[model samples]
Target chain A: MIEFTMPSLGADMESGTFVEWLVKPGDAVRRGQVVCVIETQKGAVEVEIWDEGVVERLVARPGDELPVGAVMAVLRGAAEPAGRADKPSPPAAERTPRASRPAKPQGGPPTTPAMPAAGRPRISPAARRRAVELGIDPATLVPSQPGAPLQLADVERAAAHPVAASTTRVAPSTSAEARKQAMREAIAAAMSRSNRDIPHYYLGTTLRLDAALDWLEAHNATRPLAERALLAALQLRAVALALRDVPALNGWYSEGAFLQAPDVRIAVATSLRGGGLVTPALRDVDQLSLPDLSGRLRDLLTRARGGQLRSSELSDATITVTNLGELGMESVFGVIYPPQVALVGFGRVVERPWVADGALVVARTVHASLAADHRATDGAVGARFLTRLAEYLEQPETLWKPES
Target chain B: METGKLNPGALRKILFDCIASVAPEADFEALRTDRPWREELEIDSFDFQNILIAVSKRLGIEVPESDYRKLATLDTFVRYLAERMGAAG
Candidate 1:
């Protein structure tokens, strides 16, 4: 039997309130299927099960605040012994909602199927839940093909129409000032630990992106808006590939030692529409092509805003990147997220005075800065990372054309 | 006589609806038509692109990335989109 526990999404997240269970007992779950949702300071994050199995029990009830490592569900895998399938959890007292807080009412999960169709059309279970979440009537949706099961894209298409009244609604409880206050507190706790413990060293430099901007313009000229790559993707790709020469700055500072991360996961600093921010990771970024990376980045931002990020993408970050150029700031120095030793900051790309080939000219340049933990590495190592990053950005052709 | 198709007021409504869809927290009543909304609204480049994408999808008109600067304010945005969607719209 496999015990699925509440994942520690981040240092900022101490616990999460069980929002909904996508699966119930006796349901056969596939590997990588989103099994449930947990509401953290960030938002409603869908938690995925890594192992394929039949759900034997659900230990955590909806509305229960479960701490990190608390068992959420039990599953009997294909290889496991059949007899000991149902491992009963301890009584309600021993479950979540610790002594510090009162046990809230176990309300029905938010996305209850409100439709009562006489002969409902075939719809995927995930799509059904999503339709209800958007306050959409599942019966009104059409499948991709006639007589086929309705998919999430169909619900998305229906929700995208401006005439849908339900699409405009935001949950009062989720968007309330109280939730913002809670999020602010969570950020304060994590940042306080970062400042108190990490001996951070800051560095900055201006990198020219004239070639990059020119190439981007030419590249996007022929393509439609949906497939066009953003400069942010190139910046992230540069940082990820640059880490090859500066692996020292890519991992965590835990237990008084520096451990180089295996994969280059870049946690993007995304600002939520409601209020706060979340730095969710895009895994193995170094291996991805620019187009693939751009698509994934767009999807990540969309999901982050929609309050639908996954749990596995939340916690594990080898490094963080913040781009505040859109806010019109020329430069910004960010505080490093603790355990992760480095944070990269980028100012907006702007037209500025520069000397190229011994002639004065205006060039598009971005102010790139690095904040590193001195304990992990000196300023020189961080400086080298910035140098390599600029090298990648300056040669815009190599960034995309030599795409693996 | 189909004034609604090319009307500035209709264009503005479409634009605001797209913005609201992308950034629900936008205070529409206080939003100024003459201001460069990126800095004012705290919306990043991608979010703004998403807004334009939605607008294009609604009206079935394409706006190139280079033409993004032409839409500095809500007024300019409506005007630019109105130009793309002329009498035939």
Candidate 2:
């Protein structure tokens, strides 16, 4: 039996919002098959299976905020005896599976016919819910026969559109209020778990930004307006590259097992839904060009802030970077987002004292606070990662050059 | 589209329009100044952030999602706009 736990996509991603499950109990899955989608604030990403087996059970559901290492699904051998119940049990709190959870006031789960009619089509649980929300009948929607079984679009056309009313509606009501409450509840649950379960050790380092700014100003002078991007991307790219030298920081920790991941997925902490948080990934940042990285970051942040991000965008992260600088926060000691070994927090850039030529000099510097899982990375490893990152940022010229 | 000068009534209408666009079935009449909207409105975190886009479009101002959380109620939300537009002062 192989436990298909929620793999940490990035270092700072302590928790993830379950976006969707690709397979159900009894479905055969091969290694490297994209099995699930998790939404991080950065964007949606499909998670590939590391182990091959038949999905025995799905413990979590869409919209569930699960810790990094929690078992999302259980996989068993094809020939393994089925559990006492072959049918997947619904979530304990709700009788309906996440995919089929009714948006309407239905008291219980929907009943499907024992057998399908010749023309009646099958639909996914998610698409079914979407159909319900849109007041569409899922049974009428044709399931995709070529490849994927069901999707939102399949369900969308099946149902008639709700009565279109003028934009002017009344003020707040129970529906809106209930959604807000649910979101708060989910956030509170995730944060409490992260703070309590994760062992966080914070180290603050102030990096001199004078040289970096000089280099950036010169570089930007020749670039286009759209090319001018957030300073955080440069900081993130540097940190990501530096992680290669300090491999321990680019990994995950679960039970007594410590694992190193070759690819680096950085979660850019983004503010969402007026009050909530989301971390979208900038995949393989080390390989992307400066303009490309900046553009991707802009798009991810726009979707994150705008709430158009799909569920997969929110979850798959291997590391996280939180920038409080935009909020005018001088410094913050971030809670290690779990499973991933480290989180780097960037504080506001301010003029500060620096040592140059054995004398105290005033220079603009940004304070970087790194929080690491004490169980995985030692202080030396964390320090080396930070030092190398700082060096890269200070020498921004290397970032513009094409990699060998 | 001034940075912050929308009338209180205009802002209220805008807020209502925003919610109505997303969840049309949601009852807006029940929302009041002290309704604890986070519980009463069912406005999930995503919806709350999406409102910023609407608010920005209506007011011609870029309202940060993080800043919107501080406005807890419909009345407070309107008041926030009043302040932003310098109308309240």
Candidate with maximal lDDT: 1
Model 1 residue A87 CA deviation in Å: 13
lDDT per residue for candidate 2 within A1-404, as digits (tens), equals: 66666654333446656655657778898755667756432234456775556887788776577897788888885555645323322122112111100011111112111122232233565674464355443334555455567687655544433222111111212243454454455555555656776777788888888877777666566654445545777888888888877878876666666666667778777654334566666777888887788778777776554434433334445677888665667887776555567888988778988899999999988888889887786787788888888888777876556652
Per-model fnat list: 0.78, 0.00
- Write model 1 residue lDDT over A33-131, tens digit each, in one string: 888877776666788777778898888875688898788998888677866644433233122211010111112133323223334555666686677
Off by over 4 Å in 1: A82-175, A401-403, B1-5, B27-29, B87-89
TM-score of 2: 0.54
Under CAPRI classification, how is model 1 graded? medium
Estimate the lDDT of model 1. 0.75
Q: TM-score of the second chain in each model?
A: 0.87, 0.75
Our tally of clashes for model 1 stands at 0
| Per-residue lDDT value at A382 in model 2 | 80
Tell me the chain A TM-score of model 1.
Answer: 0.81
Please tell me what DockQ candidate 2 reaches: 0.05
Off by over 4 Å in 2: A1-174, A310-312, A358-361, B1-89
Q: What range of 10 consecutive residues in model 2 chain A has the weakest lDDT sum?
A: A96-105
